[model samples]
Target: MLFLKSNKKEKHFFKKNSMSKKSYEEQAEVLSRAIDIAVEAFKKFRPKDFTDVHLAHFVSVYEGYKNDILNPNYKFRTLSALADAKNDILIYFQEGSGPDVNFFWKRIAEEKIGYQRVNKMAKILKRKRIANRMEMDFVTDCLVAYRQEGLISDEESIMLDKMIFDFQKKGK
Candidate 1:
């Protein structure tokens, strides 16, 4: 009993004396930065709608940050940080930011088929789909990606050329 008590006292003494370790402020900063990186990784795909795929992507990115980006000592549920970031991702999903959906719809619109024809198609799809999440993703992505700069000229081709230009280029 005496020996066990001595060992417990020594363990407590070391734990209490180890006050020079990383501070709470530093841990919080690192966690915030890790979450930021995780979100950016998912953004690379430009998924307009949040689906099972986006959730998987977010989980992979979060794990990457937790295991590789953070110190090995940090252990917590990845969902903890994700709970906060999920709202931001949901906004993008609501805005219809996916890759191929919008472009396809706009192509059909720009072609011989007019908006009425497309609305008819949407109605048909609405009857088939309970929630039109995928359909909406397609329409919204097209509007923002194609129509944002200005109206699409009837003379222009319907082909979507996804130019891989860097908007965040260096140098002022």
Candidate 2:
């Protein structure tokens, strides 16, 4: 006859086994709790401050580039330039028409600014025989992918929803 392990050792093994068998939901909850603690600790250590204009510009540029990314026909070079140009315009909008005022205005005007930019890009694609239906389909797919990937937070998700609704309304 073999001697059995002590109750304490058996209890320890059972605890380890039970922990390893946690369901996906239980694992997710544990991971989320850890993340929450980490975030709180980091927030306490290092806070961040951004200007309102910068925040607005960031949101605008992010949304703009995200829209561009959804376009199947969107050229990478064009997207990069558009993003750079938007940044420059934000600088100009904040810095008050510097020495390169004309250049800044040209970029901003060419890019069409805010909501108009989306419509302009869509029209350009449509004129080139990229069907409106296809573009809308691409946008919807991108939105779904973005949500699934957790790229957009709840507030951002609401914004995207509104943007999609607005786009659909305008398309009709």
Mark the 10 consecutive residues where model 1 has the least summed lDDT.
159-168
Compared to the true structure, candidate 2 yields what TM-score? Answer: 0.22
lDDT of 1 by residue, 1-172 (tens): 7455557779887776454233433444454553454355355444545687876876676665545424434443233444444334233333433443344334434543222223322342335422344544444455444455444433221212211111113211
Native-referenced Cα lDDT, model 2: 0.44
Please identify model 1 stretches exceeding 4 Å from their true place.
Answer: 1-29, 32-47, 72-172
The 0-to-1 C-alpha lDDT of every candidate, in the order given, reads 0.42, 0.44
Residue pairs with colliding backbones in model 2 are none
Model 1: lDDT to the true structure: 0.42
Q: TM-score of the candidate numbered 1?
A: 0.23
* Model 2 lDDT per residue over 1-172, tens place: 4437568887898887666444323433432332233233233333234355645555465445444433324244243444454443343233222233334344445544321123322342335422366555555655565566665567665655665676677774
